[model samples]
Each structure stands twice: as C-alpha cells, then as structure tokens.
Target chain A: MVPNREPVTGRRVQFMISCLCDAFFDDAARAAMDCLERAGCAVTCPSDQTCCGQPAYTSGDWDAYRQVVRHVAHVFHGDEPIVVASGSCATAMFHEAPIAFEGQADLPEIRRLASRTWELTDFLVNGLGVRAWSGRLPARIAVHDGCHTRGTPTIRAVRALLGGIDGLEVLAFPDQDQCCGFGGVFSISHPHISAAMGRQKVDNVRSVSPDFVVSADLSCLMHQQGIAGRQNREYPVRYVAQVLRDAAGGPA
Target chain B: MSRQALDAFAAGIESEVLEAIEIGARSGVDKRLATLTEDYADADALRRLAGQVRQHTLDHLDEYLASAEERLTSHGAQVHFAASPDRALEMILDIVRASGTRVITKSKSMASEELDLTRRLTEEGFEPVETDLGEFVVQLDGDRPSHIVKPIIHKNRRDVARSFERCGLGDYDDDPETITRRARAYMRDKFLDARVTMTGANFISAESGRVAVVTNEGNARFGLAAADVHIVLAGIDKVIPRDRDLALLLSLLIRSATGQRITSYVELVAGPRLADRPSGPREMHVIFLDANRSSVVGSDMAPILRCIRCGACMNACPVYRLSSGHAYRGVYPGPMGAVLGPLLAGNEGFAAVADLARASTFCGACRDVCPVDIPIPDLLARLRARSVREGVILARAGVPSMAGYLLLARHPRLWRLAMGLGRVLDWLPLRRLPLASIRAWFDSRTLPRWRGAQFRKDVKRGRREQEDG
Candidate 1:
C-alpha cells in the first residue's frame, strides 16, 4: 500500500460500512475499511449486518425483500451514514428498500435508512472527498459501469481518483456503461444469456486489451472474473475500492 | 426449450448474424441521437411528457377510443373492433371475402404480424403483398420479420440483394439503394392493381379521429394512394387524446427508433376519400384489435402500451445486441418485446414465450431510452415473479431456491452462516457440481473460492492483538 502524500484535513467522516457478503467475504472489505480509517475517518462494521435483499428484490419477492431490508435497517438504524461496497447492495438499501416498505409503519425509518445509505464510491467521493492518492499501478485500466451504478456522479469520482494515482491510467471503455450480465439471481436463472452478455463485455475488453477492468460494484467484477476464469481468458477485473485502498496505503 | 433458443443464438453470434444486426441497430440509434440533440436540450422532459400523455390516454382508453370511432364514422370510415387476434383476423378476412379483394397490399404493420393476417389472407386465396422494402424482402423470402421497426434487420444488405434477385425483382447489386429501387419497382405494380391496402397506424388521434402512419419509404402513403379500399389493423392502445399530442410522440419515436429528426412521411389519414377527395380507398376499415390489450390497459404492465415500437431498447440492450432478435422467439423481439410478446400472448398463450421476460438482465436500458418511459425492467421483474408463482420459471430454475430464500433469507444469522459456508465451499475443488442452478451460474465463470471468513479472521486477529496489548 502506497502512502497518501497530502496531510489529512483532520475531519472525521463516520461510515457504517454494511458488510456486503460478497465484499465482506473477501480481503477487499478490510482494505476499504483501512482505506477510510487511514484517511482519518471513523469506520464501524456492524457484525450482525446481513444481506440487503437485492437478490430477492431483483427477483421480485417483495415479501422476502422487505424482511431483509427490515433487518438491515434494524442493524444500522442510526444517523451515521451507511456505506456499502457494492452498488447493487446500496441500491437495495437506498432505492429498493423504501419502495419495498412503502406505506408501512417503518416508512420514516426506511426513508432515513435509505437516505443514509451510499455506495463506497459515493461515500468516498462525496462523503469523504479524499481524492489524492499515491500508488504504483502503472497500467491503463478500463472502468466497467455496473447496471445499478450507471450515470452515477460517483463513477466520475472513481475515475478521477484512479487518474489521480501516480502511475495508473483510467479509461472509459466502449460501452463501459453496459451491464456485464451479473444481475444476481438473473445470472443463475438465465445463465446462457448472462454468459453470452459476459462474453460480449470480454470481447470489448479484449479489443481494448486493458491491464485491469475496474468497477465500483464488486458483483460485476466478480462475475466478469468468473467468466474469464471459466473461459481461460486473461481479462483482468478489480474492485475500485480495493484499488483506491492500495493506492492510499490503507491495507495489504 | 428457451435454452435451445439461446443455444442457437450463441451459434448465430459465431455465424456473424449478431454483428450484422448490431451494425444496422447502431446506425438507427446513432441517427436518432443526432436528431434528438438538435431538437431538445431536455429530451427526458419531452419523453416524460409523452409518457404522461400515454398514461392519461390509457387511463381513459374507453372514452378516447369511443371518440375516435365516432369521429372516424363521421369522416366516412367504418371503424370495426375485434376482441382478440382470431376475431381481428376473422373480421379482416370477412371484409376481404365480401369485397372479393384479390390483391392486398400492406405497408409495414406489426399489428398485422401480431394478428398473423398475411397467412390467413394467403390461405383464403388473397395475395397479401408487403409494400415496405424490408417487409417485402422478408415476405418474398418466406420469413418472419425479426424486428418490429426494421423487419429484416437480422439480414445483411447482401443477403437482401440475393433475395431480391431470387424473387425475380431484378439483377440487383449488394448496394442498399439498388435493392431499395428493385423492391420499389417490384411493388409498383402491386400498388397499381391492388383493390385493397392494409396498414397499421403509428398513432390514432382521438381529437381528430385520424390515423397517423409514419414511414421512411413512403410505401404506406403509396399503398393508401393507389388502392380503393384501405384497411387499418390497429392495437387499441394506439389511441391518443389529441392530434397535437403526436408532436411529442412522433419526435421521440423518430429520434428513438431511427435517430432521425423525422421520417420522410407522417400522413394523417382521417377517413376514406369521400365525395370531394380524389385519392384514398372508397371504403376504409379501421379494425381495432383488443387481443387482451384492453386487459393490460390499466394493469401493472400497461406502461408497455406507451411503446411506439421504437427499437431503441433493443439497440441499447447488451443481451439483445449479442443474441440478435431471433433469440426472443416471439413476434416482437428484444427488451420491449420480452414484455409485449407475453402480454400480447395473453394468459393461455403466455407459456409459449414466458421465458422471454427471463432473458433480460434488468439493466433498465429499455426504460432509459423508452420514448414513453416504460419501466421495462420492472415489468420484466413482475413477469418473473408471476412466472415463479405460476410454476413456469420454477419448473426450470427450480422452486426450491426461491421458496427457500423466502423462508431462510428472513433469518439473518442463518443466511450469514450459509453465505459464510458458501464462501468456503466456493474455494473447494468442487468442479462439475450437479446443482442445476449452481452449475448454470458457474458454468460460464468460476466463483471465487477463497472467502473462508476473511472478515471474521481479520477481526479475530485484531481482537487477539488488543487482548495481548
């Protein structure tokens, strides 16, 4: 991990990083936490945190979706803005959570929970505004926009941070905003179509031949990685948070 | 069965058909964007206006449709209503049979395709000639239209040229202009001699009771011009409240579909050529095909009714671009088609293309580019939920998982534990797993298998260090 060159502003932004199962189960989660803490932010991990029910919400199981949203809201019910590592999970919390619990008694709380919820990139860029970083990733990287995070301002922030690195170059690949066919249960339920879409994204990646394909959302990166691994293709994918963390000398 | 369609689609991708369709699709959307940027600074606001209009019209469909019928009748056109596709075909066939209409020339009409009118006409010894160049090529080749807007989008111009030559239209070159002229030449005589012409209206204005037909080739105008009897097969959902409302709809439709400022022609046919008018059919038949669309009018998926049949969603869709339209296995193809196809199919017919809705990644590209702002992904998600409850998707993706998630996902501790185990199991050398859902998800990509409670392990180490200190 490279060290940050600029002095910390001495301002502490508290982030309750919801333990997204996908990122949590990986070293990337720790890196993100360390990245924030090293940047002079107070970060807390709610251990009882569970799934945001994005899978169920996307699957259209509103009843089950409500339960998951309810549990997440209960776990992180506070004024401290909740930050998530994945866009889909953040969407589930911010957007889908309120919609799922509309007209309910917990509507106020649900709205509050949604208002506080932010994807990691959004939190880091808007919440923290910690842009400057020093790192040694000296290669052109393609930015893959997850379906849930397309047209988001934080995406621009992520790119700006990536470009701000000492040696890294970030690119807006052709059709970078296109979904990489990782629609959670959609991938498993409709595997053939999903795989076909993944192949198309890979083809675009191959044409560019980028050293790394970074995305704000972990699910898409993870899905693309799986596809590349299965096909024995050399398409490299990385989470933007992990990359940023490594640049900030947050964690190994 | 749906899997086989996708399998064929993968093969089609290798065969270069997807590339051809994508190229055509790209040009159409590129043209649309250029036109839109020139027209409005806030295109989304315009789109929203159109959507609001469509929503209002759908809400009062009975009133507007009645107003349209009354106005069309006064303008000397007999407006007929059909309850379903079968009824619509029967009504059109009855009119054709009674009139002894031999040659039926039709401009591009997806409604005609939806009602399967051409086959019925052909079976009844009526030559149903397709006038639109793309439709003409598709008809001559004994093929179905893959795209709603550009019927022969799947085929390259070279293939179309070959088809033109094969059909004896001319010794055509691969050039699109040559093929266009050849098709026009071949269809010229059909326009001259046809007793009746069939077409679909892009929109029906209730205020004026006029049917607006939009086209690039002017074949629809030609057909209406040459033929004595004009028959319009329209989806009941096409009715808008006012004639002026077409301004927003047409602008968005043209930009979103062809990325052009406007089509070559947007003819508003109010009625038949009465006592004073020189052209148009002496008798005009406007057949409103209900076809279960009336049922969808105020229903949850009615946002799809606002679709002007713009292929922007298809062009914007990654999956549709990869597989081409044929993979959908329905009259309409792509994102909009996934919803419309099943909706048009109705309850009994839904099972045939129920899987079409499943094809989407729920990426919301369709909704984003939609001229009427249809929530395509939400409709698709609703369709998925309906399928699960109806046992259609359950039969394929399995009921156990959805059912299990509903029950166990409610328990946070249990789900976390299971996910934790899943993380550990993923890293294990468990290749070629027999779980259908798992196999399908992992078949194309390997799930990372190194989770092993990394968060917990790191936390535990931190706690140990704190205790030692």
Candidate 2:
C-alpha cells in the first residue's frame, strides 16, 4: 500500500505551488494549474499555502517543522484533495510528515493533511482517471524519475501521460534511476558531492542527447540544468506539467 | 564539525575511485533487481516475511540471547558476552594467547572491523592474515575496506596489481583471474600456518547453537579445518529464535548481498569437533558483542539491528555512489553506516557522526531496496531530530533558517511580503552574491529569475475574472 495516501472522492482540489516553483519556476506552476483545470478539477489555489515544511523537517528541527505543519493543516483543512505540483513536496507531506509526527498530539492533523495530499501526475492519472492524455510534444524526451517518484504510483502515472503524446519519442539513459542530487538542504551542506552526482546525471543525459529532459520534480531538473548550463552542454529541461500543457496545445 | 571531515574525504577521492564505486555498486543494484524479480514469485512478500522475522527476533532478543548461550554451552562451545568492541577484543586476546599460535587466519567480518581485531592482534605480536581476497588486498595496501561486501570496490585492477607487487606476491598482473589465483595461493599457506580461525556469524540459531557463516571465498571452511581454535565474533543482534529462521534469512541475505542464488560456501559451525566428528576445529569460542545493541533495541534506532550485513543499502545509495564509503568515516558506511555509526558509538559518538544523516537527500532508494525493509530515511530523519534535540544545529538552514521560514509561513501576509522582497533578486546579480549558500548554488548552475507571487497573483486574477463575468 502507498503510505499516507487515500482514495480520491471528488473533483475539487486545493492546489499547492511548491516553494521552488513559486519562487523560480512559475511557468511550470502555471502549466500545472492549466493541466489541473484540463483534467476537469475545480482547482483551488490557497493564497496562504507556502512551503511544505520539508526543509525544516529534513534538517531535524521538530519545533519549527511542527509549526509549519500546523500552519499547513490550518490553511488546507477540510475534505478537498490537496494537489501539489512537485512530487518531492507531496512525498514530504504525505509520507515523511506522518513519520515525523508519530507519537505526538499533532499526528492526527498531520495524517489528515497527508491523506488529502496528491502529486500532480498521480492526481491526474490515478485520482482523476485520465489513463491516456491527448497532446503532441513532437520531441525526443528522456524521463528522469526522481528518487521519490521511482517506486511510487507517480512513476506509472508519468509513463501513462507521456506515452499518449503524439510524435513524442521517449528515451532512456544509463543511471536514469539515480538522483539528480538536489536534496534540498543537502545541496547547500555538501555542494561539491551534490554537484558530482549532478554531473553524472547531466553526463548521462548528454549521452542520450534528447530534445528535452523531463521530470515530475522541477527541483531535480533545476539542479541538472544548472550543472549542464555551467558546462556549456545542451540540456533543455521541462517540467512534466509544462510538457503536458504544451502537448495539450496550451501556452508554451 | 564532521561535515568538514565528509567534505575532506569526498574532495580527496580521485575520479578513478568514483568510477570504480559507480560501476561496482550499480552492478550490485541491477543484479539485485534482476534476481528478486526473477527468482521469487512473490519477492515483496518474501521480503516482508524476512523483515517480520528479524523484527520478532529483536523484540525478544533477551530471551534469544539467553537461549543461545545455554545451547552453545551445551554444544561444547564457550560463549562469551561482550558489552563493547573493546571488550570483545580483550576476550579474543586471552583466548588466542591461551590456545593458539601467533598466526591467525581471518575471514571477512564487519563485526571484526568494529573491533579492529586484526590491528590489535598485530600490535600484540600475533600475525593475523585477512583471507578474504578483497580484504587481503586492503590489508596489503594498509587501507580500510570502503564497502561492506566488496571490500576493495574503490580499488581497480591496477591498484590490486600494485598492492600485490608491493607485498611480493607476484609480478604486476592486473588480470582478474590472475589476482584471484595469486591470492588463493597466498591464503592457502596462511590457512595452513595459522593456529586460529576468526570469523563473523551471519545468523546464530538459539534453538540449536548453530552459527551460519556465508562467504564467496570459501576461506572460513579452509581456515577452520587447519586451525585448532575457531573464534566467531558476532553482534548480539545476530541471534534468531530457531534454526528454521535461516531458511528465510539465508535466501534473502545471499540474493540481497551479491545477487547470487546461494553463496559459494555456507558453513554452519555447530561446535568444536566431537569424538565422532574430527574434521573441524578442536575448540570453538562464540563471542556475542553488544556494542550498544541492547540499548538500541530499546530506542527508535532498534530497527537497524535487523540488518543482515547485505550491503544492498549502500549499493542503492546515490550519495554513496559519488562519495563512496570513505566519506562516512566509520566502519559502516552508506545508509546503514549513517545510522549505525552514531548508534554504535553510543551517546558520545552521536556528537561526531550524527551529522552524517545530514549528508543524505533522504532519497527513498535505500529504504526501497533494503531486503528487510529497514526504513533508512526515517532513521536518518530520527538522527537529525536527535541532533536538533541535543542542541546541535545540523539541519540545512539550522535554527535561524527554520525560524526565518517559520516566521514567514505562520503569517500569510508576511509570506507574500517576503516573496515580493525576493523579487529583488531578478534585478540583481545573484551569481555575485556574497552569501556562501547562494555562491554554492550559482557555482555550477544559473539561478533562474525569481518569479515571486506570480502564480498566486494569476490565481487571484482568474478568480476575479470568473466573478466579474
């Protein structure tokens, strides 16, 4: 069973623009919004939804992490599913938060938040029952399954959505199963090692030489694209939402 | 701080070592996937069963320990309990001095590595030769094993050739077969000349006092036959309730470790050779090393004691792929090492190695691939929590970072206000920022122009449009 996930029951979802996407990749966030609307959901964007408390939780600051979780619980409370643009953030909320809040009085609220959280791809395919999408990307795209999404339902959701794109040639590369090394604060604490891992991923993408490197998680792409850009390599990265939006003949 | 230590270790690693680790570890990961997929009809169910068995054993470890001691004693084996690695070493020294020659042939044992047994024996004037081929190369090079199962994974063929030449084994031959042949000949002599054989038990059955030791090299069997004394050093966590438990443990262990259906050699050392069975060692000593395992059993870190020494977690670890095991700076490395390093060292060790948990991205690959389903990411997070509770600022942003983010998150208006302020980065040269964190980020990748509050604004505008229409 997928941990902390509950079956979707309605068409309404509270959209969560991950901090990374909110601050840097607004295009991807907008694309995610468009795709969610296309999937026939009454997507509600809560102005108060900020960060997912991943950084604080990962850093081991329980007091600060709880404050953030409590804030999230208050902001996104009630029955509608909370759909997130990023897989890592959704995983942090749906998976790690429950583990962190175990044995605490705040666990029930955290568990409630987790039960309603959903990644964009999983919500589109699994929650909304969009097994195949109609679109035309018309490019060779290599999929980088972020570490968090590799073994989850989102991996299949990504494949099902991408598989339906017309004229899109999906590609695979060596070590594509590896992480792109944007481990949030890990990149800050151990930048060199993180960059080394990013180099390997970027090099693997270079070997395949696809038209674009697409992933459900923008954080991974941001890290890989950064390394590739500095090295003067051709690494056009697109978020899964952006690809889906473009394929559906929406704004580029 | 140990962050510096991990960084220093990573910086010193050459490209060659990184490539070796990637190749060696990636193959283990791929093979493990292949075996688990093809070998079992219900692999995950099998894994769940294995996890349950280990958990049950740990939950009742006190009873198993007592039963194991009683059964081992009745089986004509001396059972010694060690509260720590130092105590285990001290006991081994006395047993060696009492009944063996200066030469001891040792098998590959992570438990012994914890004790630093070979070095301690050498310091005491006893010649302890590592018989595992990878370990022998490591011994010859005066280097520590970077990997758990494959000791010299960081060393390529050329490194082995150089080490062999330095040890006067043969002329420089980097051929894999030649290296194995030469090591075999060298170890054959050590096995014959040694008076004591040292090994680590994979699983000890409390019901039968049978110790199962699996190896690919077949060294333990050879050394035991030639030696008069057999010393098995194992963690107290290795104890299981019954002999039948080996069926599940051994299957998962061999497949998980090296992707083999079965190891080349499986030695179930029952006890010393009896009057009717004269083929084995004349004396046997089984030392159960606690090394804070009993304390761990009562703590949140207890699930770590379910480890079967498979090395699968390290193989699947992406951070370990780049930094390798050396960066961990402990006997155990990778996902398992990150937790075990701090826990085994007890309270004092927490201050030094608890930061190792910060080195991870908390990627779930380690947890996914773990045969016994050890929740490594959760354990790493627990370590991080412990670090914070102990007043160590090991998190990414530390307290100030969390406090700053929290202050903004608690108030929606403040979050928007601060995000608007972040838009100033769009007009400034973010790459030239004097901040170390930003500098580190911009070192390799171009920072995108901050699009602060645009998505939120768009959502608000869309709502207004619908209402107006």
Candidate 3:
C-alpha cells in the first residue's frame, strides 16, 4: 500500500461500535479499526459501549434514556475523544446526549461528551487529518446520507471525508436526504412501512446503478442490505469505512 | 368519541395502514415520497412567504386579533375568544340558544372535533350536520376522523355503505360517487334550513381582518352564504400578516394537499356580508381558541406555530401512509401532527402514540414540504430527547430493557463477555438466543443474520498477524 501521509501518533481515541456493528457488519468495524490505527491514532473499544439510547429515546422513554446516558457517560468518562463508527450513534451523542440529561447534575459531562463525539469519517478527516488515501479500488458507489448525519450538523465533515477517497466514483441519487425507514425498533414494530421505506431506498440505489450503496451508519446499511437480499437485488450495501479501508489497500 | 371507541378505531386504522405498506412495497413508497418531496421543494419560495407571514402575525397576535375583531364588528361581525374547548362550546351554545337554531351545518373543522361540538350541540337540543362528504361519512358512522384532509380515508366503500345503512340512508349503492351524491342531496336541504353555520378558517388575514377559507367542495362558502349566522373558529396560529400572504399559502396548500394548483373556491370573508351580495350571513362570529398553543409558542417548540395545515407532511410521510392518521390518535396525524399533537393536546399519553415522531427516516421530506419550513425531524428529535429526560417514554413502554442493556454495556468484562458470546452464538446457529430479539422482530420483517465475530476482533487479528510477520 502506498503511504499517503505520516500517521499521527499519541492521541487518545475511543471507538463506539454501535449495536448493529457489534452484532453484524464485523468486517466493516474491522475495516474501520484498521483505517483508524493506520492513521496513527491509539484506539480502544470501551467494553461498556452499548446502544446510544436512541431506540428508547426516539420511542419517548426518558427514564430509559437516563440509565443509558449515565452508563455511557460513566464508561467513557476519560479525557480522550470518543469516536463512533456509526453516524447515527455519533449524532445521538452529539445532539441527543445533552438533551437526555437536561436538568441532571451529569448534564455538564453529557454536554462535554456530545462535543467530543465524531462519526468515523469525521474523526479521520477532521480529527486525524487523514485527508487522502493512496490505495486504489475501482468501484462505482452511491452514498446514502444517513438521516442523523444529514438532518443534524455533521453533513459537511462526512461528505468531505468521502470526497477525499481515491479510486472511488461516488454517484449521487435524487432525494438523497430521504430516510431509509429503518428507524431503529420502528422497523421491527412497524415492519410494513419500514420494509416499504427500505424497498424505496433499494430502488434509489438501483436507479443509481452503482456497485455498492454506502452510508455512514451500519444500521441503515443493514436495513437496505436486508431489503436488497429479500428482493434478490444484486446491489450490495456497504459502510463508508469499509470502502475507505479497501481503497487504502487494507483488509476486506 | 369515548376512549374505547377511539382505541378501537385507531387499532382498526393501524392494521389497514400496515396492509397499505405491504402493497406500497411492491408499488413503491420511495417514488411517492420522492415525488412529494420534489413537489414540496418546488413550492419552497411560496412556503417561505407563508411562514414569514405567519411569524409576523404571531409576533403581534394581540394587536392583530383586536384589530381583526374591531374591523369585523364594523362589518357586522362579532368576535369571541374561546379560552378552552368547553368555553368555546358554551359560546356556541349561547349563540344557538338565542337563535333557536334547530339544525347547524358545519364545514370541515378540526377545532370542532376537539370541542366535541356535535355531541355538545346535540346535548343542547340542536342537530349538528357535517356538510363535507368525508366528514359527513365519519359523522354518520359515529367515528372520529382518521385523516385531517381525507377524514374518511380509513373507511372503504363497503364501510361507508354499512355506515349509510346504519344512518338509515336506505340501501344506497356502495360507489364513492353515489355515496357523495347522496350526502350532497341530503345536506343541500339542511344547508338552506340550518339557522347557524360553523366553519374553520384556513388563514385569518390580520391585515384585512378577513377569514380566508379554501374548500374543494365549496361547502364552506355555501354554509356561510346560506346560514343566518356564520361562526368561524380557528387557532391563533392561523393568522397571517397580510392579504397577499394568503396567495403564497393558498398555492402551497392546494398543491401539497390534493395535488391541485388551487381549490375550486377560495372564499375571502372580510366580514359577515358584502353590500353588493343580497344573500350572505347577517351575523359573523370569529372565535380564536388558545387552549395550549400559548405554551407551545413560548417554548422552543415555537416553529410548530408556522404550520399552514396543508397536510403535505402527512401525504409525504412513509409512516403516515402505513399507519394512517388514526394511529396517531390525535386531531392531527402524520409528521406535523406527531410534533404538534402532544403539545396541543397536553397529554403525555399522546406522546406514546406509536413512536409517531420516530416513524420518519429523518428524510427531511416533511421539513422540505412545510410551507413555513418547520424543521420537523429536528423538532421530533428534540421532543423525543425531552421525553427521555422526563422518563415518560419507558414508563409508557412498561419495561426497562433499554436501561438493563445500558447497565450491561458499561462493564468492560461484561461487554467483552457478551461480545464473545455473540460470536460463539453466531458460529453455532442453534446457540443463538434471539440476540436483539430477532425472532420477535423478524415476525414482521426479515432479521439480519449474524456475520460472526465483530469487526474489532478481526482488526486485532490483522494487526497481530502483521506484528508476527
């Protein structure tokens, strides 16, 4: 693999492998780690890392949110920056965490954590300064803008990171800002709508006719992948991290 | 409607919504939502103007409302502020009592639903009739509206036939056109005889003190024209800054609502009657209801005040397409309803209305379509976050599984062990213990199979291999 830039060293970083990545998409997570470490940052996965309380929070369970936020805040109480592999989780932390602890004493810590949290690509480009990759993997890819990333303030950082990758042709689809309809447990409870939404996303991806449909959130990717598989569609759903790792001439 | 009735109706509608989603999967929801998004985006400039007008009116609501009242009175109109639903009902009761109104004809108005106006009017010994075909069907069935615009969307033709039979319409054909024609014929007589007419304002122009009501059927115009007294009930948010602003809002309203460029009739009632017009309501009363809107406006949730009630968000929302409006169990349904319902109703129970806000994929389509550009997803997230902070969410869920998982997640050894167990289970299919409740989950949709060991382990293995080499 050709070296693009000297890997930065000695920065403390933690990985938040979102629940979907923990249970599925192991390769993408592995790819994310490889890319992060290669960029010269010391990374550790917090054993206590679970969900970002998004499911409960979105479902309107405030009490459940506190327990989850306290648990996550206590687990990653150290001074190091928390880097999340999933855009949705990072968004939860950055935007929802503080809101989750509004009047509590832990509000300050939650706010601090929110400010420190970053999506993987955001951490790579903005935090680690790994703007370009030297490795080449010729593939036409369509980028699916995850809802949390697009609806929140994190869009620019994610887009810039994806744009800097080499040997990757990014195809833009119309209405890219639309949701894939996997809204966490919503897909499970309201499957018909969720599936319909997923199918819509699959169609958009198919319309682009790219080799892979890529997104920052594995949860969204997994949902689209399920739709593709069920419909027997040929397009693959991939994580942006895995694509970047592959383009860097790293592991699969 | 009683609690039991509402629950049954909501459940029935929700099931239908699920079925629609299944059909939509094959027919396409993405294309539909995309088409709507494009249409809404096209109306962005007009929506912005409407939003600005709404903002200006709201900023000086007191001044405009007073000015509107005075000007309306000068034109032979009476204005009343309904502090609450009961108070509004009482005001209506007083008016009807004096006029000896035996039959009252109402145009489509959600505020009337909130006040249970029909029930109240019936109790006060006056017959209340819904003139709009959709609302008339819902009224005949003794059912609440399932949708704001398409109030009877939940009712198939068969259901309408059943309702018509129940209402003693006598063996009518189940065709939609036939049913509509029957209702129109029945309502035509009531429209002429009814002493009191009740209607909702689409936009209350604070500039000209005119109430602009847009209707496809022209029933509102007919009701206002024929009745001895016309009562216009609206929330404070309906006020716009100027007459010109109505044009912008009307454009967005028509296109987003029914995909039409404009409704058949746009009735601008400056007051009760025009001197040139021989036949118009002799008396006009505008009732501005403030219920819980003041609280919403004072809080960070103020942007909800900018809504134009175009129902574009409902049509564009994937969840609403599946669950329909009844599932929301509020006067409002869909994206805008999910955000505003809880706030307006002030019911914590309404907050649990089927993860309504979370129903969106955060596609921003509703926000894009919003005439006033209310950041619907952002508002939803904020509300959800607030719900989490207050502990109302999990209590409503009746379990704390999420908290338990968070507890397990915080311990390093426990988390690692859990991950290791997940890996083992992945290898041995039989060992899988429904991790993430895939079975219960997959009953409705396909479950994502475990891909074996996590990405962290593979990454560590790769690094170790490199070091050994």
Among these predicted structures, which one has the highest DockQ?
2
Cα TM-score of candidate 1: 0.89
Cα displacement (angstroms), candidate 2, residue B349, comes to 1.5
lDDT of 3 by residue, B193-255 (tens): 899999999888777788988888989988987888888889877777678877677766766
DockQ (model 3, Cα) = 0.31
Question: Quick one: best lDDT, which candidate?
Answer: 2
Residue-level lDDT tens digits of model 1 in B109-131: 88888877778788878899988
Tens-digit lDDT track for model 2 on B190-230? 88889899999999998998999998889998998899999
User: CAPRI band of model 2?
Assistant: medium
Which candidate would rank higher by DockQ, 1 or 2?
Answer: 2
- Predict model 3's lDDT versus the native: 0.71
True contacts kept of 1: 0.48
For each candidate, report what fraction of the true interface contacts it reproduces: 0.48, 0.73, 0.45
TM-scores, all models, native as reference: 0.89, 0.95, 0.78
Minimum summed lDDT over a 10-residue window in model 1 chain A is located at: A1-10
| Candidate 2 stretches greater than 4 Å from native | A4-6, A249-252, B1-4, B393-400
